[model samples]
Target: MNAHQSLSRRRMLGLAALGAAALAGQSTITAAPRAAAAPAAGVSDGTFVPAVVVGTGYGAAVSALRLGEAGVSTLMLEMGRLWNQPGPDGDVFCGMLQPDKRSSWFKTRTEAPLGSFLWLDVANRDIEPYAGVLDRVNFDQMSVYVGRGVGGGSLVNGGMAVTPRRSYFEEVLPQVDADEMYSTYFPRANSGLRVKNIDRGWFEQTEWYTYARVGREQAAKAGVGTTFVPNVYDWDYMRREADGTVPRSALTAEVIYGNNHGKVSLDKSYLAAALGTGNVVIETLHQVKTIRQRSDGTYLLTVEQKDDGGKLLATKEISCRHLFLGAGSLGSTELLLRARETGTLANLNSEIGGGWGPNGNVMTARANHVWNPTGARQSSIPALGIDDWDNPDHPVFAEIAPMPAGLETWVSLYLAITKNPERGTFVYDAAKDRADLRWTREQNAPAVAAAKSLFDRINKANTTMYRYDLFGKRLKAFADDFCYHPLGGCVLGRATDNYGRVTGYKNLYVTDGSLIPGSIGVNPFVTITALAERNVERIIREDVKDSHRD
Candidate 1:
């Protein structure tokens, strides 16, 4: 009963938005109200539960909350710590400029996407292996970025709560009802996630957003239409940070690893709301290894409890009546692929590891003119994007990312989501006990080309060129290798039914980004949350009518 346990008990599992708003000078934003967890009937070690959710991400949070509201007892398993306890720096998370062991997931060094600046290895740092927040899972040709904590990807993403265009959403996921999504679920998801826009008047005058202003002006030079993107970071709190009234997290560069304050991550939003339901509980540092069916239509999961140093503590057997996999595209897909290949869940269809894509992700930077100094002081929170998705030839929504290197680097960074038709596949490797991505470098050619088509025009019109030296000495302008938005591995219609029910398994569900087919032409979390909201609502109403009979 120390500080960490006390915090969890009082705040509802990592203190959700209530504590976050309080830390941000009592900001108006807050998550679901805190309700004491209902006393468990008997859920404990080697015990049974009415429902079990794997991963505490957007989907898992939604599922747990909805199920709890429907009077179901649910348990959530996460591979990382609660992240509520502060470290020696008096912060729960370390900053990007001076990252520590908390920046990486059991890696000896921090792997920043911008590996270097001016051909110098200044971004990444050597660190000790720990069960930290951000994790980079390297496959043969692609490196997938994932968040390793209770809040999942919400802890590490850019906080861009973007809802995809209705046309694009219909094109990617035709099975989903577009009318319900755009009209109902999208707004509901935005409200739950607390998405907000920065004031345009503040944007014009603040030095913090000068980087985005320059990006917008540069895109305008190429006749490209730039739009302001909404984010989960508190705009009012950010204004205070810029004014030096509040603690600096986004302004002083606190992203990629984790944000200390102002960011309304899932631990404070959906997950917090889920915890407030009193029927849900989360167990951290527990990784599910295998999934097998019990004799009486129950699911048996072989889970490992580990310490932050990667020490195996115990292996436990837990059974659940219903199982929801919300461990993102990579984690959720691998579990099913392994179960299928190893003959555990033999009925799983061939689509378990198919229709996987990188969402046409490509990262590139432009060498801005010396006259247009893109501000020495910048906020890590992105607020603008060059929207060229209407172009029929190569649709792209490029987020004008900030190069928060704590100095005026004279660079305009972007992470472009292109409409490339290319997709990848995942193959389970029996020897390594892992699912290996079959995506090769050649597969990324179309993605790079689509991004180049848009950026080339900007370069030509602005009389600038690509920053070849940023990505190391190879002179690769576009970073087509690694991707942040990893969608589709267990695709929606192909891998499961229209409502995300597993094709051959009755009580199995896929509720994360694995449902989308490769590309969505925007930041994916909002779409993921909305789709989860839609799916879980139907599930609680139709599937679990008698779930509480016990």
Candidate 2:
């Protein structure tokens, strides 16, 4: 079977696991045994939980849900605030077209990782201090864009829920059980994330996807095949959006900030279900600073609560029998590196901050001819990708991204995922209290070359050239300074055991994108979720349950 067919079959079988009750938006999941009183608010409360999961991203959400389901009371600590409340402007997130301070964290001026039109510092705007949905973490050469609020990257990403090619999976994670991953955890993650493909019939007819169709046609003309990318957005709602029967999100230029509708983010899926268990508590804006093991084998965490202005409110000491780090790639890596540097976790594996990669992300735009007419009515959720990963020399899977500039710009944008083998390392800087990535822009050359090889073919076939206007100034076309998908840092089998159990420390786990060693050739969240699903099950069965029995 082709990739599309295989994906369909997997989706069908996974949906079968969502029994009638869950399909009807009802829960049959029973609450697990409570470990202690729900997580306390103050330091003096002497609070403790059975397990503490850091961050509110995919891995954290999955671990929290699974641990709660297994009767292991869990507490999740997030550095960013919960983004469920609408501001005075009547929206929880700011749109990408008009980004304000709500687009960034603790900054009076907004810093969008993507530079403005003509690279003229015009995209960002100033606003009052508030906890935004997106954060642009700047390093020496790379700027990583990550979501900061309750849903994490789901709050800002394109909602593309893609599984990496199985063959590539084996090559990247050689020790992982490929059969079990494809047959079990991958489908489970897709089903839980509410992933769905766009209706092909609607895609063919909708004006919103004309840009994508043009992209496919151009790619086909260049002998490059295109595939429909699956996403976590609700397809039925998107269909209604096209028919003018519902309020639009994907059609209304709603990505890279947060989708107000049609997107089934983690907040609506796993995290919501976890809360229903009553054994999971999430403390937003509580950032874990230091971690040290107590004499009794429990872990002690020093957490600082911060307000919207990034001001510290209180520092609390909390203890947990088990600690799971799910604070994405950068956050988790920094926490561990800091602990190691300060001698808190002295014997942490030497590979703690190694094997980091940006998933070979490169963004560029093609200036289509006026006759091509890339549409003004464009969907924000990309539904197509030019699949060129089979190319042995320059493998590239380029997503047909939306310009969504609210007008016909005749620009075909692409975010190409390439296979670059370069890896970087992170080091803790004592002076700044930050973790610095040693990756240089020069290391991104391979990724750019891979992307250019494919796009150059399309450009040649179509008699079009790169859109120098979309990216920053100068003749350079590819945007290589930033990455939306930051993978690795604390890699599997290196920093941790195969099951994500950190070596030298019992009950310490790493369950985020940090576990991915370098590139995965596709979006990392699904893989992170599946891996967490696999590891947490074993941990509960072999570790948690055994300890309780003992």
Candidate 3:
């Protein structure tokens, strides 16, 4: 048999055994409840219980784990399956893992299509209407990526763990005490995600290393001063590369789609722990379509459950005393916006869909002629960054993350994080059951100019360092596109209060990328996770207490 067939057979056997073991102590396992399944007509007479989290992405996972730890019972509802098996695509490799197109585990049910590196397939889709007047600017020019599964984007994201610049954090989330967040939330997220730097030893042998080394050298010569940063991955796997036990091919640059190794997604971290708590239960393949608040302050959720082929199986209503919206920015915003626009929840304020931004993210690639082989593979870890962000003269918050070496024909790729003030709008589409997002340049003139000018300088500097071309002579080629790091939409101060409490809605909270008020000038997952941690903790300590008194 071919390698894939053999691997599939072995995996099936292992899963069967695991199923037997799990069923040994329990009765027959019924197919999990479908969100579309009908529910009993009457309101639940059962006592209003503690909060139930209705999503299992990063925000939901962290919130569920923290709530469970705090002795609160939570039921997490996920629309996608848990990624426990090696993805169907044999492309599952180690360091800098990328998405395997062959993986049966990957789902394309929603309208938002994704490509390799979890980048949005903008060419295939049109911009949503509420995205404002920018819809006419050719959304095909933009690329935004999102993940849908047990761990959400954490599963498909490049495992770069960067703490936002301290100054930027204070400015945007000014209500949050930076000292407390840095000391408490940041470290907590890093530890939970198993964040670490790429060991310099193992990366030396890989071709992907050549790209990063050349990029860093070119940036430094240009006076950008790039450095490696920490990542959420297993250091031991990297050590094995050093020992030659694992091949450089094993660390294939397949990040963004999904990684077989190297980085730790939520499935292995927060979700795993939450599952172990026994107090927390997760139901996958359940999509929440709408939410209604009862007179007694309880939440009734209408969900649609789908079969493997994406057919609607059933619909059901679930009631919970507390509802946590941890669906990523797109998913959560879509749900809220639909509910508001459709008059399903008309009481929501005008701020429900305001303050959207793409975190000013742009993806630009630079080429280097002489491949700097020294520690190239090990340097895949982004240990360096540029401080051009905070300069009042430039006023752009930006950083560069290392791209895997050897993937491209030339030297390296760096994801430039600029403070692009460009804002996008997220509107609900009931017919499509998705968010129509539109990003425009007319509203983002400064951000657009800044992105072009910064890359122009980098391109000019690369000429001095090496003999390769940069950006293909396209001055503003990359701005109209987007990276996977989407932020805002349901911003903190706008859609919800400072503590993530939605205005005019009690006992309902939002915790996810949706809570970010605006662009954070960095990869947003770490910030999202940290913010969820802080918000959940506050709810347990403050909101729950207030509820008790009431």
Candidate 4:
């Protein structure tokens, strides 16, 4: 192999070894330990704990950490793998251009958001079914893209950590106190997540972010202003990547699958701290199938322990005095809906499956003029956004996304978060024993129109046109079918109480994207983390510490 390739190989091997050792040596809480499916015959599984958190995403991690810090013994259940060890290629994750079985969740082929390029299906690849990092849960009209590992969505997202405008936040959740969220919880979430911003001086000169600059310039041509967005990816490490000072992850198109370096996922931040508190334990490859309340006021969960190949190893039952459903929008909503439908948790409110939306997500690409060539070297981490949210007509915050094909495709892609009032809901499908989203393509009309409104202005000024070949053979430009930010389903004020307490149950709580109603006007991770911080702080103060029931 070449010298650079050989060096990268050795570096990845060393990292994998260190990660394995760290996981193995977390008894005193050195690093976050991810226990494999089921232990040996004599070992006692974590079948019961003082508290159980049912996810490892932004909100779940926050809840776990706070509970652990509050001295509550907590067990976190994650369905996906830990994703710390290197694979056959000596890397934790595969890049976008070349994906493997590790790119998707139990699917025979990868389901990349960008399904096609130049009308060719060059984005996806067929592989064996395995528990991969990213999962595109397809419904009738909407497909929700979620991460599926120890750190959950943090493992697969673009790492854009954005807080919504206060006015819009009030509009979405008026019940939430804005002063506290802005002053205390938001900063706390930012600190815990290690959110950082790219240096504008470096951003201006770096070849890696040329696409963002191009996007900004094009948007400015139409009088639409752009704003810098914060992210969890280490900006300094990204600059070093551009300078060839370290092995590349973002520069090599490693997003949507996972990032090996630079990015600070929840496992590296909150989950690690939760483990360090010596009160949190994370069990991977354990999926919660159903949840019910016991007669004595405790909650019981029917968990399925499985291997990476979808082989069911054991059907186990776990119980907790306090239960937190921090699973992503789909997983948590489905579990509660199933429980309610099966008469297990009969007191679960009707709002458990209502108020679902895709954060008004719409993706479109522009064929830039040959002269305005976006650079071939692009960072997968998005750093810029078109800040038109204040526009009273059709508010939108369109992020300048990277088309990191490792070559110039002459395409400026955008994933716009529009303020569409349309929302979807989930219904219990008894035959399949799952919650199905009752959303139609017609509901996305407002999002498409809002996106077209902004892009049309840009296209008019730049004399550019939309790329019709990117989404499919329908000659459509706006991709409204899939969304990266899947919000709602167990909405805060509607499905759960103001503090994430379930409306009908005592010790059950909802703490994820499911708490948000529809749109967040930007990326939802920071808001999710902050809201979780707000909710769990109150929860721990009132419920866990004092044994107060909601």
Candidate 5:
């Protein structure tokens, strides 16, 4: 069968089986037993109190693992349901990989208030007067993708694992010791996420190869060399694809929405292992509304519990000696910004919400020769990257990679590193009880121009195999506004100190993408994970130990 025919047949069968399973009220796959909680280790019974880590995304999961490993008791509060759970729509809700686009899964999730690209057209039910909330910001100009589940953005990310360019890291994060940080933390982060290269065979057999080949040809024509790189996915499933045991439909490129067979999100990786430690307790469906500081320096958090209908059923108050904010750049920044503006933690410096940028995550597709059969482009991503754009003279950072195609013959994604824009502010709408994020177009103009220029160069150089018509038109019309990577509102220097500590609030820290000052020019996950690793280690070795040692 042709590729399209095979894909269609598999999709039909899978959907039919899913329907049957639902009707029978049974799952084809059985879930493992929940892990039991273990006793706290390191601290005295009375002295070692359980801390609550709010938000179950990247930062939260990483913090939970680190704290749990240190024997510190922690309760992880996730506003979203587990990605592994069945949603109200009777479909599995894996953030970026959700098979059904119309699923009402976000309605029941606490983090649903945080918007996403998949539901951009659907109103946010959690926000009252939904029209105002939806219309308040620039959705057309920028595509914002956020995760509202147990794994958060990890559930929706492309699963490409990339370390930031060395110069970008050294220049942006001077406070971080690059050599030690990379050596100690990068490996640990990659291992935890099970990062590895996509199998060469899978690339050769998959349609994704066609897409990547086109991307490479286009890059080469522009005098830019493209290379394959590793991704964070289960190799076993990939092998199954090679054998055709699992149909190619199983490896379909429907990633950013959620991947069914590919991608190792936090729920399956770090969070799962942390649960195994039995020292981590996760509370799903708990949305943190406010965080207050008590007289004794402890944190008093008010959280609301929401049901599947997206209605608040109960409000609960919890106290913890320490609080870790891992709500991504947008989520964390909004929370901290609201607290500061409302005088809850007004002593924060001028830096709060001072540095914000989208990591220049512009998404554009390049067309390649139709005859070049980029095999199985769905299962594997463009593994190699071109670093020629790193030159200061060029003033741009761009990585050319293969994109999974549907109807298109072959296409690749070029993520460019443009100049960082001025920090944007996250204003809290008291009426809506949520954040209203706004950014000016002028802030990213230079980066946008630089990105277009880079693509134009690539297109001109590859007249034989590739073309850059879309990028050229986008540059001339200035209409390309959506970025896969959205970063920085409560940036590292402003919202927190050099060490990721909130300036005015004691025992409170901000990690994750929020700590990234501006754009890193490549996929930001590895950098975020590595930084979190470094910060958490420091917190354990310095702050936590010093408190006990003294």
Candidate 6:
């Protein structure tokens, strides 16, 4: 047999042994467990699976793991390639300090949402073609920043795993079983994601957290409550890095590009456990282009395989009895929108691309006094946030972000999550064969106004001013054109049923951040994961229970 076949056989034998050992009440097994089907490099010809999950983010990871635990085999498809392997520089990922071609997708120039430094071109660079980790999908009025690799946003985010308040969650998804979500799925998702808070003792004294402390003090002066945000980053490792006992990740300015260490991304948690179940497989570098249903109720997907240079190597078709859409807000919406417009799935409801929002994202900077140094050593992992969501007029939950330039810039950056009621729609552009986000520049005004209302109070109380040098062209405060937390697009109860069952479709579901109606008032990954956990449990119990009966 060939090496691939031999490896697969060995993996199956090892899994069989592990199962036997478990049944016999043994403590452990000898062989390291592997995924049910080995992770494929690309989409092979004539591939078929019992189930397929598109994208490997929080929603996809949770569904894959839960389905695997239920003894259902699944194949995950990711647009970007795997990032766990080291490159020629002996590092798995490029750092934000000097981002190379690996920082973006096929673009010749990097397009960081924070595009300019002091309104100059010092932040971006031109590079050759490569499959980068972060992708900035641009629209006419807004740009959405999303992670592209196997771990999705987890690969590029600040590891801020936050759950929205109960009232806010209920407001966004009222039909959802909030009781089950709070009592069961929320806690289950948190434990599964390995979310933790930073050490209070270390956060107070560490030089790395001085930026956070500066914001905390100013927020306190403004009489706003500051709360410690939980994250997926390992706080123990961060403490060791502070003491010089371990290698540094957050201290080394590793946030946007990718963390080399100290961050526990989805690849290390849910995705990892999913693979250990021996019933889940992931196919990287495979982008699903279209999805259509067969007459027999199976789903047919057309996927394209691409090389690092953005060359399309091949196109292949895969069929699955069940399909899960975990591609984030934009991706999942675009796919269904295109399919609906092209008559591939004409029965799809018109709400397929409606109810999109930017999660009320607004980034701003506050200039601290010269006497108040915000510290040169700033931790990329943010732990403190100014929680003013209870304010009836201007509700905002602003996280004190880090500006880890390795020098004291005397600026405090904050990414405020507001409660903007505006929603956008994705319209199919037949000329471009893609969906366009209908969010206009004017719609973002309310978001910026809300964010400014909260930050202005803190700035005025602390004798601070809005920093003009951070954003483009001496802008005083609030960059409202881009978002890191893109939510909605395929809203629950509209595009799909309350349980994420896409209208007029069987054995197909939407299990991602796209299910949220518009605003959630916090970092959305935790809510997305919890909602997926709740939906998948019902799906398995009601939809796929009989098929999995072996």
Which portions of model 4 show Cα errors greater than 4 Å?
1-46, 546-550
Candidate order (TM-score): 1, 4, 6, 2, 5, 3
Looking at model 2, report the run of 10 residues with the lowest lDDT sum.
24-33
Q: Which stretches of candidate 6 lie over 4 Å from their true place?
A: 1-43, 548-550
Number of the top candidate by TM-score?
1
List, residue by residue over 1-550, the lDDT tens digit for candidate 6: 8733543454455345434443553322223324444334333667767778999999998898788767677888888866666677877788777889888877788876565667786777888878898888999999999998878999999888888899988888888878989999999888878899877998888888889999999999999999999999999999888889987888888889899888878777777667656667676778999999989888899998777678888898998888999999999999999889999888999888888899999999988999989999899899998999999998999989998888888989999999999999899999999989889989998889999899889888998898776667666577988999888888989989888889999988999999998789999999999999998998988998857432
lDDT of 5 at 188: 76
> In candidate 1, what are the lDDT values of residues 262-322, reduced to their tens digit?
9999877777766655667676788899999978889999988888889987887888888
TM-score of 4: 0.93
RMSD of candidate 3 to true structure, Å = 8.6
- What local lDDT does model 3 show for residue 473? 27
TM-score of 2: 0.92
Please, what are the lDDT tens digits per residue for candidate 3 over residues 34-87?
A: 222212221132323366676677789888877655555566777765445432
| Global local distance difference test of model 3 | 0.60
Misplaced by over 4 Å in model 1 are 1-44
**Error in Å for residue 455 of model 1:** 1.2
RMSD values, in order shown: 5.1, 5.7, 8.6, 6.1, 9.1, 6.2
- Write candidate 5's Cα lDDT for 1-550 as tens digits: 8733543343344334324434554312111212233323211212223467778777777888778667666777777554453446543542323233322343232122113322242322332211000111234235465766667777655577887767778887887888986788888788777788866776655544555555666666676765566677766676676577874423555454455565677766777666544456665667778777879888778777665446776787777777898877777777787787787877877676666677765544454455654444344334556655554544555555444434444445555556655445566677876666567667667776776676667756654322334333222222235555667766676667777888887788987787887677678888888888888888777766534222
Instruction: Write one digit per residue (lDDT tens) for candidate 4, span 210-302.
Output: 899999999999999999999999999988888889999999999899998899998777877776555567777888998888899998888
Report lDDT (CA) for all predictions: 0.85, 0.83, 0.60, 0.86, 0.60, 0.84
List ranges where model 5 is wrong by over 4 Å.
1-49, 86-143, 201-206, 247-250, 369-377, 380-382, 395-405, 409-413, 464-479, 546-550
Span of 10 residues, lowest total lDDT, candidate 4: 35-44
Q: What is the TM-score of each predicted model, taking all chains together?
A: 0.94, 0.92, 0.78, 0.93, 0.79, 0.92
Query: Which residue window of length 10 is worst by lDDT in model 5?
Result: 128-137
